[model samples]
Target: MRTLRDDNILKLPDGRQLGYGEYGDPNGKPFILFHGNPNSRLLWGVIPGSPFLPGTRLIAPDRPGFGLTDFKEGVTTLENWHNDVIALADSLGIKKFAVFGPSGGGPFALACAWKIPERLTSVGVFASVGPFLPETVVNASPTVRTLWKYAPRLPGLFRVQMRFFAWLARYFPNLYVRMILTEFSETDRKDYARLKVADFLRPDRSEGFRQRGICTWYDAMIPATWPIPLKEIKIKVFLWQGKEDISVPFAMGRYIAEQIPDFEATFINGFGHFWIFEHKHMGEMLEVLVPPSSSPRSK
Candidate 1:
């Protein structure tokens, strides 16, 4: 995928430098995109002509330990994650904005909603991870279930595993890409084939691991303690789920929808975990989260 322009750096109060890339309109309504695990800000480049481009300033930040962002000490919990986001927004002079979280990014988006609902216009989660309870795990894909069950307890093992994958992604790019494509459902496979998505994914996958393989592994291994105060979120909340998603499981979305009051949940049949970035699905989500408005466009 082609790299986007306006890759900027923000120096936080603690002197940590945060790296981010700007997509779409620079002066448009701020819309933050939280990338999935093992991804960086560059992941946004994969979405072709994103609908948010019309009137939204899509901000993709390289989360701690990813891309050019430096990792901070004692910044592991969800609260710390949200605070980092808030700090970034403050540095950018943004008071309010919408947030979109896909896959592993889901929990971080929810953290923003939970911690700073007063500063948000809306929250959107697509193919997200819900409360990681026993019931959710029982119904999840074998790979997902096993990771959630054992990763935390075996962090060293998980790190070693990620390092191996990173080595494969760096050296045997084509084979590594094929290994990932093989995990998608039939519907996802069809979409991916038609879209030629692998080209866009290659850079992010390779660079993301190269920069923060250990940190990503550590973050993924941490267990999620549920009952996240979803009921307290005052901003508009939208949930998009793929009924056929094996990575997160449909049950996770259902559970989250039940917890959030007045939340809009859309379940797409035959879609998989990657549906959020698929052309049709992504268009639908952008329409709901960033409808074309007559309001003056950002400068």
Candidate 2:
């Protein structure tokens, strides 16, 4: 429940500030948490309570302009975000830590691998977007347009396509939430609704960025276009994908897992997009990020 709002402002070289939250032991090694598109870090408590709280130090930050973070006037590219993450960790005096990227948080986590693998002990990616081909977008559901607004620059009629998506978010907010909610499994839906979904599930919660629909549109271009490719990364990776994932098709997850240089990929049949949040094995997941402390000998 503690947040960066109470902590000192973490300023990046470019002068942007990151909104972050810390849970569990402050002295413990850090594990920064990242959430997905249209979401703030509020998605973590969906597990009823974070498994990270007992011993692990979990730092959850809202993307600039998303949650409690100030959306400053600057380009919110992968590099900038990554640097901000680094700056945040530096501000906290953490030299090494693991990263947990879930859904939208996946891209930022991968960026951490790309930029600061030397400082990482482990990295876990959950159903994140990979290098998607533009052809996929051309053939994607109409929802793809909503995801295209944030790309570097879209010549020709791309802006017009973005207009349509903005229209949907503005006029059909309820329907948009339902469309997104449909991707979550039944239990995750209940868990999310009851837990931490409110800050991220509505336009009002993301009011500053609501009209700046470019972030979603920009997220679309990422799978098709990565400024820095994952193939160039040097980190060993672990991932969880659900075969039935609809939001981010499990097929995409499988594709990335196979292609990443050193990866351990796992797929759970019948599991869907939100399965990472729906997991009964999160304790194991946390163990990967924060290993248990050694115990004393018993009598």
Candidate 3:
């Protein structure tokens, strides 16, 4: 199938390479996008006419282990993820650009802010993460217990474990939804068909994702805590979230805004994890986060 948008390959400064797409003028102001895990270059493809597109040049790269990029079979960590992205920007001859990280793509953008704060116009997150997944859902939910029901080729013993949990959750459907809703509080409650399946998935879907042109994104499930060194970041910061989301919780968006000093800026409400389109105050959002073309620094 011909892609709905133009795509290209980017060779980084260090000899490593990756696939990417540049929307709008290549010479225009750079606005690089970072996609979440278990997805290819598709996540960044969603926003074409977003309020930010008219004036900003958009660049999105496939992460090392995700999209078409590769590294043997070693574990993929957030730090490695960050370096690979920086390499992508460097490859493009982009000294600095406004950075956008959505969902699992958050850490990479933050890492750039930390490592090269000067090369940033701003750092933004939409339905991104910072804290560990909650434990109550882990210890109590039957939905996660039966997380393997959709796995067909698993060994016999694993099937038993899955079936047992399925029996518990399936028979008591309420408990399953409750557990999953609690567990996925950041994304479970949002509108669909907007962000596409790229924003949400079941565990078994991991294998299917590879078939659709993405490596497994299970690495995101590994828990960790991190701070983005906000005090050192001099660029403007923006955050937005969808209230009904159940995957990364709107609270994190607020947390990010408040934690970062320098006039924490605006946090728009009612936009779900997938709701980056048609924002009522888009021009204002852009004015603040996208940097002013007339701003002295931009000059």
Candidate 4:
């Protein structure tokens, strides 16, 4: 089992570095895990026991500006991410793979599905926001809604907020975890303590802040005017959301699901965003992405 300290770097054609963490069976069915905002590839550490499902090779990558990945300068939209994902897959000699996005990573996952559906075997998103319109922003958690309210109009103030978040994640890791936990529902909070999620999240959160909060801010802000045409996505998309999720409103998930041409969803009553990564829950997600008949046991 490799820890988050292990670094894997791949230099892309654009002269930027893409940093990723490879977990589970190296030769197993390839599955890319797109992490959320303010989290690095090390977010994989949050899964108790192994991060990947049986017979699934989990490739968790830091999107530009998070963790070891180089931050892109100026205005870059979510559409640009499929190129990186394709490049990474080609480098790994993977012809086809599944993609799972959690939280903010949802847009990137959808982007891949839209732009490179031929290369994708499966796609899914858990507790993620979609097409961050004014109505969508209204569905966000109070904290996130407040940030969305100000992030565009008050760019300087947003940067200051991001800097403060960086400081909190770096200097007060425990508190940082707790602060995030505060938004979780009571159901999720209990699982947080039982699973010791903060233990795994502390380092991941700290690494996410290594580049400070500007990248995270940009990442969070991109969906406001999503470039991907969800109606044109040719691949099937699976969605999971918790009605009790306060971090990302359940309606956001519903919005995306409705737009997707081929979509299936499972909305749980009591679950929350953070709790979806619980080992068993993640396993179930993988089961849907890659059914038992097609999946072989991990060597």
TM-score of each: 0.89, 0.76, 0.65, 0.91
Highest lDDT: give the candidate number.
Answer: 4
Name the candidate that leads on TM-score. 4
Which candidate would rank higher by TM-score, 2 or 4?
Answer: 4
Q: On residues 71-100, what C-alpha lDDT tens digit does candidate 2 reach at each position?
A: 544478777677787777778777778888
Q: Which model is ahead, 3 or 4, in terms of lDDT?
A: 4
Q: Write the per-residue lDDT of candidate 4 for residues 231-259, one digit (tens) a residue.
A: 99999999999877767777788888888
Off by over 4 Å in 3: 1-5, 12-15, 48-52, 71-76, 133-190, 193-208, 211-219, 225-235, 263-265, 278-287, 295-299
Model 1, residue 64: C-alpha shift (Å) = 2.1
Measured on C-alpha atoms, candidate 4 has an lDDT of: 0.79
93-160 per-residue lDDT for model 3 (tens digits) = 77767777766676567667667667776777666655443431232123332332222234444435
Candidate 4 local Cα displacement, residue 225, angstroms: 2.5
Sort all candidates by TM-score, best to worst: 4, 1, 2, 3
Clashes of 4: 0
Q: How would you encode candidate 1's per-residue C-alpha lDDT over 95-211 as one tens digit per residue? A: 888888888788888888888888777789987777677766555767677777777778788878877877887889788777765555667777777777777777876657755
- Give the per-residue Cα lDDT of candidate 1 at 131: 68
Please state the error at residue 110 of candidate 3 in Å: 1.2
Error of 4 at 21 (Å): 1.1
